[model samples]
Target: MNVHTPALAKAHRFDEPTSVFARDVIHDLSRAPKRLSPKYFYDATGSELFEQITVLPEYYPTRTELSILRNRSRAISSIVPDGAALVEFGAGSTTKVRLLLGECRLGAYVPVDISGEFLNAQAQALRADYPGLAIHPVTADFTAAFELPEAVRDMPKVGFFPGSTLGNFEPGEACKFLKSARTILGKGARMVIGVDLEKDERTLYDAYNDTAGVTARFNLNVLHRINRELGGDFDVGAFIHRAVYNRDRHRIEMHLISKKALTAEVLGQKFSFRPGESIHTENSYKYSIDRFALLARVSGWSLLQSWTDEAGLFSVHALEASD
Candidate 1:
């Protein structure tokens, strides 16, 4: 793959290449209730499908969060120290960060993501757009341990985690991620995060289950990835996408239900699925403002400020690292 990185922007990789997908997929398929990690849903095709999902009429999170960021960019910029390096965890699309880049006078921008090719392409575009600012794209799973670019080590760092991605993690995992981010950002670091607000069940359900079926394609892209990259033989048509609100868990659960009894092979291993068995794919948890504030407080961050849209469908939060 040809990844164009400008002279001003150099890419970094913290983890070595490995067949983590094959190992995890085989193991998860053998479980009583089969499962797959959502991280796998970011190959080129999956990423494109997700970008489509963000624009669907039923999906309010993306546009709502964008509104909050745009309306509150000034206030959010106030909290960021001058010359601070902005570190974005799971920097998927550059759409949201452009607001910050245009608003804040940051010394550097570091976009960390698991998709190396996509990340590099975005980084190249950012460098051309912002020739004066430094751009360092790191290809690593932000949820795991990874080092920031040495160029920005001594510079103060601010974390930017948007799109209500924290909702993807369970409560405990969310706490762990917040704590890990604190450690990564270091002392006196501030964080700007986006959290989806808990709202009517119908709205939440519709957000994940769109009428255009783009979200369905995004969910099934995982199996397609397995087939392409891992030499798996999965009847992509035999499994249908399913997204339902799990009220008791306060999260949206995405699954792939087997259309009928079938067997799929991957890495020379075979797995059988019952007629109606499902492979749990992803979870997106919504939080009330107070609930998320409490979560941040417990996770080593003091909630500095939280803003929501007029309809209160989504939220943006500013946090300061606690002593």
Candidate 2:
């Protein structure tokens, strides 16, 4: 199978005899006792594990997001006008998308994801389900500057950003992402996004470090990724998983802490970890409604509608590009 990546893609995908997109940055991050970004967790196995994570009793983000979509879908359908392409940023499972397509008269469906293999498979299924609707699947990092095709470029596109994935980005990066969407959609583009609201620490803690053990696998899988991609030695069993709420940051942080002092090498790089030293894996930030609105305002998007769950555990917001 051939993957058609842009000029930049070759530098990123190693298997294609691709050029490396890093100046030792990849090796630097792969060293244990170091923190890495969460984007790398979508490797095939990690993606499947995340699907399992969503269903666990402790993981409420996906379930809660689905609930909001179900409760307000009719109103959301009414608000987002028809004859417009509904574009999702990281269209993973696309659990909410089926509801949108069935409830709303959408002209086209556009999904962008880093996992092209899974993305194309889902796109094929989506195409079969909605033969009348156009499916333009794009394989690119959502954080990059992408050029839309001519047909999609001219449509009154409405962005659907569910999953509270925006929280994954650091504050500045998140703002830039919102701004990029505005630049692409231009003035008059409507958007509906999900933002997980801040809740109690105890509740947040269990969601990431679940009793089911799948979340741990997902966290450690990053190390496995290093071993496979960059060549690393991660025992995958010599560490303990941790998740905590950083009150100062208002985010849940996941960590893998070494149980004992250990030395390991990966892709020709040596690393040492103390017994208590930890590698920060990911952070899931929960926002207050006011904070989220401020983020949208500062990013050049206007909040049209915002609704919280009956329990106020999550929020679904409708926003539009202002400039």
What does the lDDT read for residue 158 in candidate 2? 90
lDDT of 2 at 307: 82
lDDT tens digits, residues 216-292, model 2?
99988878876776556877789888888899999988888989999866434457788988888788888999999
Give a tens-digit lDDT track for model 1, residues 74-134: 9988888899999999988899999888889999999998888888988998888999999
Regions of candidate 2 where Cα sits further than 4 Å from its true position:
1-33
Candidate 1 global lDDT: 0.88
Model 2 scores what on Cα lDDT?
0.80
* TM-score of each predicted structure versus truth: 0.94, 0.90
Indicate the residue-level lDDT of 289 in model 1. Answer: 90
After the best TM-score superposition of candidate 1, give how far the Cα of residue 150 lies from its true spot, in angstroms. 0.4
lDDT of each: 0.88, 0.80
Error of 2 at 33 (Å): 6.8
Candidate 1 regions with alpha-carbon error over 4 angstroms = 1-18
Clashes of each: 0, 1
Clashing residue pairs, backbone N/CA/C < 3 A, model 1: none
